[model samples]
Target: MSQGVEFNRLMLEMRSMQADAMVRQKPVASTPEPGAPSFSEMLGQAVGKVNETQQASSQLSTAFEMGTSGVDLTDVMIASQKASVSFQAMTQVRNKLVQAYQDIMQMPV
Candidate 1:
């Protein structure tokens, strides 16, 4: 009778621990608010950031070319490269968006 009681107690403790573990491991899910923009909005924001970076880079290049006291050749080169990369990335994104739209249109409805 004592052994039976001990076994039952152990099983209860194990079940309680399992329940606690499961509760702790529950996944968190979030739903976006109404009127929130979707993936395209996020993508547009990212592209805008890139464009801003490119513009800053161009300004830096101009400053360097004008023989500004604080500007250096290396700084200008790096800025130019950064701007070029951003421009290329934006171009690629535009191309991909266009292609996706075309593919969707071509899909049989």
Candidate 2:
């Protein structure tokens, strides 16, 4: 559908804008507090949230298929779409990270 295409384009544009902003951001190196989460920890948490969203969507779809009461078609559809979008976004992030890693590896010391 055209709407879906448009939505995807918009999402990609937003992601590019975000990446650009991050590229232009100034780094402030400060010592981490003893109890603070590291960068990897935050990334893992984000991935976990994406996984949770997909799992929730799967559960809702299963419930609807089983004719569970109070599970509206609209809600199921929305959940599925949300899960799909999140998964796609996560995939894009992974791709970008891989590309960055490759770029870094190619750089000469």
Candidate 3:
């Protein structure tokens, strides 16, 4: 295959992997009850997942930098991008939460 075709194939594979990961990460819908996970627990879990992704990306990059034969440049790039996007998403969520807290603080009793 041509160089362009090969690159495109790799990109497609990366995207498919990302989508599958996201699908697997989604929680199943369930009725909220006293025994259910609290909002704080859910948020904590989300943050933990983001941290895991960043750590995974770091480890992959380290291996690639070490010239590991099993590490592919394309895989490293994909992992880095995934980590970046997830981090950005988490940051946005944090910003929104802070803003909401500030708004509530300023509200009249």
Candidate 4:
């Protein structure tokens, strides 16, 4: 079905984005180039992206529920799934960050 194909495409897109993020990451000891975003800035941008995705999904669902023309059920479902996956990914990253922080704090001074 076309829905399955679309879902596959979305998953591929997410994987590519993850790869790009990995490529962008820098080592802790390196000095960032001028104008490059710092680690905190990058993290903030990622969170912003997740927020935007969720908002877009909400708007799409609302439009579909309101009987707006050109709103497809499949599209709404896909958007909702994308939002859910992105939120879960963000939550995992947050958990990892918290764990790292706790580990660092427990280090011998």
Candidate 5:
């Protein structure tokens, strides 16, 4: 469904970002590209998005539990699942980042 499509799109974006990072050469100067956001900015934005998703999901669940009109159970469930999936994806990314850092730190000088 739409969720599957969205997830696929997210995965594609991640792959493209990873490839781009790998393909990039070291810059002569410390300054980043004029228009491109820094890695920290991108990471912050992603975290913000996940936080937003979880907050929205929580609000939806609360509305449903309070018997608010026009709040469907299916919609609430879908939001919950989306939030859960996003959180899992973030966790996996964090784990990979940590592992990579450890591997780099353990490298021979």
Candidate 6:
């Protein structure tokens, strides 16, 4: 078969494997009571991920600036781009959450 066809087949196989793994994964059900920290916990986790991504980007930038021998420019660029995308996504989520909160607050009691 052609190289493109082989690559497509490989990608299909990888996706199938990923789907199977996801299907077999156990679900974690939360039993938090009302007024608990479900929202805070999710927000904290998202913020933590964003912070980690930002730190990775900062390190990559520093390595690039310091002319580190082991750091490739392409890798640094990719890391920075990934961090930027994640930051943008987080900002969008925050905006939507704020809008939802405002809408709920405006509803008649």
Best by lDDT: 4
> Candidate 3, clashing residue pairs?
none
Task: Please write out the lDDT profile of model 1 over residues 56-103, one tens digit for every residue.
Answer: 878888888787898877766665665565577668878998999999
Clashes of each: 0, 0, 0, 0, 0, 0
Query: What is the per-residue lDDT of model 6 for residues 34-99, given as tens digits with 9 covering 90 to 100?
Result: 654455675687678778978998998998899989998777776776667668867987899899
Q: Which segments of candidate 1 are over 4 A away from where they belong?
A: 1-37
Query: Residue-wise lDDT of candidate 4 within 1-109, one digit each (tens)?
Result: 6657756876786688678778877888988778777778878988998899999999999999999999999899988988887799889999999999999999999
- The RMSD of every model to the true structure, in order and in angstroms, is 21.2, 5.1, 7.4, 2.3, 3.0, 8.5
Weakest ten-residue segment in model 5 by summed lDDT: 23-32
Ranking by lDDT: 4, 5, 2, 3, 6, 1
Encode model 5's per-residue lDDT on 2-109: one tens digit a residue: 667766876786688678766653576766667776677777877888899899999999999999999999888878888898789889988999999999999999
How well does each candidate superpose onto the true structure, as a TM-score? 0.62, 0.72, 0.69, 0.81, 0.78, 0.66
Give the alpha-carbon lDDT of every model.
0.68, 0.76, 0.76, 0.86, 0.83, 0.71
Candidate 4 TM-score over all chains jointly:
0.81
Worst 10 residues of 3 by lDDT: 1-10
Ranking by TM-score: 4, 5, 2, 3, 6, 1
lDDT of 1: 0.68
Which candidate do you rate higher for TM-score, 3 or 5?
Answer: 5
By lDDT, the better pick of 3 and 6 is 3
Better of 2 and 5 by lDDT: 5
